[model samples]
Target: MAESEERRGLFSEEDEGDPAPDDQEGEPRTPLSPICDPSHLLHRIVVLAFMCFLGFGSYFCYDNPAALQTEVLQDMNLNTAEFMQLYAWYSWPNVVLCFLGGFLIDTVFGIRLGTIIFSLFVFGGQIVFATGAIVNHFWLMEVGRFIFGIGGESLAVAQNTYAVNWFKGKELNLVFGLQLSMARLGSTVNMNIMGWVYHEVGEVVAAGHTTLGVSLMLAAVTCLLSLFCALVLGALDKRAERILHKEQGKTGEVIKLTDVKDFPVSLWLIFIVCVGYYVAIFPFIGLGQVFFIEKFNFSPANARAVNSIVYIISAPASPVLGFMVDRVGRNVIWVLCAVVATLAAHMMLAFTFWNPWIAMSLLGLSYSLLACALWPMVAFVVPEHQLGTAYGFMQSIQNLGLALIAMAAGSILDTRGYLVLEVFFCACLCIALMAVVMLYFVDYLKGGDLNRSASERARLQKEAAAHSE
Candidate 1:
């Protein structure tokens, strides 16, 4: 009878011990389990699609001025120097504001608040620009563009933050590519249709034709749509936070300006690459329609058509290239390839009499490839808490380059010729290639694993997990 009693006591002790440990462990794992489950895949995709919508309007309005460049110059009776201010105004203010904006997103404001506020700036700026156009006040238009610049690039930082928040380490590169693709699509649609909108609206205004202001007003409508998407995304993000308990076990880190010092040498090299590559591309695009007209002797309409091929091809190709990067993981190699292709394209434009279409199409592809490969690396290197500031600083530098280069390129075109500008572009591409090479070496020395394919990275992740177990 005493032996039977002792056996029962042992069984009771085992039961109580198991429950104590299980209860302690289960609480933490409960919140994380849902995220790892495949069932949440649809939720993630929907979230990504919403994120894409947030930038669509910003991209559309940003490019509209370039799309209607000739019309704005002719209607406003402005010289090229004055007209280039439209781009300069959009770029110069963002030099400092983008960094601050990113700081706010990381610390003071958080992603949702920053995105909404920046988007509102975009909307308000577009509206003010349209009003300036209606009044035929050049100063007012410049002011409006300046205001738009305040929000434009900063909003871009917020968008990056959002993508990292939701998609980091889970097809992140591909998601960025898709976001860029959507943005480029907005620009492409603007290129394809802005001229038509201008002409069509003109026909409607009692046959006297509409003013450039009317076309601008139409672009403002797109800004408003983007603002609406921002609000919707904010709500959805909040809901997800609540449902997933994403913040339950987390502490908010205080973001400091000094955090900038922590970024690796590789990131700085990437920034220089970004500035060089974009200076070669965007400023050229800002001036490209004129290039086509001057060099190929094409009409304004035809020039725009040729210029837009970059955006048009990028709209579809960016996401695909991003997916390949996600699967393959040779981001640095792809970026180098892009730099080479861009250099070749500019050379053809500068030196050869080859069909501009061939050169333009190649440029479009290169632009897409670089974008998909380069931007995601920021996320890979920087901690999530600092991503906003990191992305912002990069934009600030990029904007500075773009602002200075656009103004200078305009002056150069007026004084020298398209050949000089094309040569300048080639020089920028060469510098980008050099920076990219430096980046590759820095990454290699750090064992960043950025040089590996996506599958290889995944294999490494699995091996680490097994070893830990």
Candidate 2:
């Protein structure tokens, strides 16, 4: 009987020691596995489409003034110097509002509300512009342009944030490239179509018709289209929430300027590089057609068409550079772009009289290379949580450069002449070259290779493995 009792005790101990069968296998699997399944891929497509539509709206407002500058001067009875001042008025507000928009989107309102509010400003600004033009009120036109800049600057920030939300680590770089490419596509369209529109409007005004009324009507249509696209995006956001359960959840806490006290020095250098590069580029984009007209004696239509070619080339260049950044590495592509841009700038300044078409073509390629490479580098140096704020800060700096250069370029053209413009271009190129050299020094200090950083390559491999599992 004692033996039997001992055996029973042993059985009891074994039963207690054994893990539950289900526990051994694994915890009960959640039925909601694959939370971010591709079943809702259509929603992502819709969101991207809407983003492109918003892009169209922003570019239309930004590029229209350039296309219609001559007509605007005639209608407002302004001289060249006054028109240049007006252009400065239009461009400066973007610099001021970029930081505000970035902070508000990330912290206060979130993407949806931020997008809607700013879009309203865009619509309202268009209306104001139309009214000012119809009434022949030049000062009112300046007011409208300022308001439009405020709204338009936010569009880029909002769309960039949206891309990060839906596409992070999942072909994200390509999506970023596509989004930026679409924005350029919008710019190209505006440059081409606005030239025709301006010609038509000028003819109408010359025939004693009210061109402003017709232009205003067109603006109304575009604004309505933008609103409709934003609504579609809203619906897509809801669908994404259903599929992914708060699909666009906050990645992390909003990083304030104070919080960035310890941000890496390399990041600050990157910011400076971006600012100098944009300062050289954005203002030139505004003045490119004018430059062509002045330097080449091309008609307005031809000049605008030539200018559009840059963006047309850029549309493909962005995605190609993005893909290369992903495959080859970011640093390699960035350095190459900077070097190429430097060469192009020198070529343009030196050879403008050799063949204006050749100069313009090189300029276009230079713009494409720098733009595609520079913007994507933001993704590399900043933390994902801080990307929106970081980008906003970068853009703010960029706008500062743009605003100063636009004013400075115009003033130089007015006082010192076009030869001064060439000197300024050369100076800008040198600044850009210096920035690239700094980037190289930073890379060296980090013991990083420009061709291939082993750590990043390994990280990419790990990410690929995770996705596969």
Candidate 3:
């Protein structure tokens, strides 16, 4: 009951004052900062730049096994079934831990501490993983990956909390998109470079298998870099809290397990959309190279190269699409557009005789578009305090889907082949389209303006300006 009242109070200030009067046509007014002051806004952008690096190491290390699958198998003397355990280990624990991690952030540890602790998990896990590789202890590596997953997804939740804290309602969409773009860039970099790193290490060691451990150890170096970024970001967040005196201000309601009941129909719809859309993309990409090599008659090298086009395109374009969302504020429209594009991409892959490049590129663009526009909506519906839980729960659900669907898709591929796999992905994407359309209706019933970015920005700016006055 107290929590409900707290939440009501949190959102009740939706239009606390008449908006700051608009300037006349062709009249000049001082350009205002998005938040408390211009200096603070500048600081926020710098924080965002640091936020870009928080997940870099995790992203790089996450796909290392896939990138060097053959080398890892040979180095560990493991068959395909055993090698698959690596991903399972990374994903399984996250399904539960991410939600608890978010809960801890909101109720117990707070964002700064949660980030540092999660980052330590990432760093420590990498060290253990690298050690396992060096010792040819496959179980040890699994343990390392388990620990890494605990940190990886929870750390992502922490990053989302930080983003909402600093950027909510003012380019929040763009910020989330930028963060994802960086993470995807990290993945793309690992895919392109890990093989080279392994080759380079092999040359220096001048041995057949001895270099694999050392090459894998290089990933630990990236994790260490990520830990450093996390620490720095924590300090910045602390300083912002202190200098801005935001601690004593109106804050989010304290989170409770029962608070799940408070999540609106729109948030649930969004969650469903998140799970379905990601199941369509990430799992397919995991198996896509093989699919391409088999179905398109491409050479192994070229197939892998073409499969990478999705990440490469998304890496640079996500932030730009996010900026467009910020400017336009039609988040539902953008999300639906993304779903349509994803469906088109899947249909082309499944049924068409067109160039594969066109299909892959469309998937990339739509992936970027959905990601940027989708995440910020949580900020719109949920208050600041529970942002951690909101993001955490979404990650947990998404990871569960990723873990389950990857296995299912792989099983289907083994039995039925590429066409069947495409059908499965297309089906998930269609569900996402339906979920997104439902979101549009829910937003419309509540007041469609929530889907518009420009008015929200203006309102936030007005609130900030009025508060400053």
Candidate 2 colliding pairs, count: 0
lDDT digits (tens) for residues 2-53 of candidate 3: 0111112123233122222233244654565554342356767778888888
Global fold similarity of model 2 (TM-score): 0.79
TM per candidate comes to 0.80, 0.79, 0.75
lDDT head-to-head 1 vs 2, winner: 1
lDDT of each: 0.74, 0.61, 0.73
Candidate 1 residue-wise lDDT, 57-127, digit = tens: 87888877778887887788867667777888898898887557645676677788888899999999998
After the best TM-score superposition of candidate 1, give how far the Cα of residue 331 lies from its true spot, in angstroms. 3.2
TM-score of 3: 0.75
Q: Which ranges in model 3 have alpha carbons more than 4 Å from their true place?
A: 1-51, 73-84, 102-113, 134-137, 158-178, 204-211, 231-254, 262-264, 297-301, 379-389, 440-469
Worst 10 residues of 1 by lDDT: 1-10
Judging by lDDT against the true structure, name the best candidate: 1
What's the true lDDT of residue 152 in model 1?
A: 82
Clashing pairs in 1: 202-210, 328-453, 328-454
Per-residue lDDT tens digits of candidate 2, residues 276-385?
65555655656667777877788988888876776777678755654555465656446557556655754564455665556556666666555545555554556656
Residue 295 of model 2, lDDT score: 76
Deviating ranges (above 4 Å) for candidate 2 = 1-38, 79-81, 85-87, 164-171, 203-217, 239-253, 330-333, 336-343, 346-351, 376-389, 449-456, 459-469
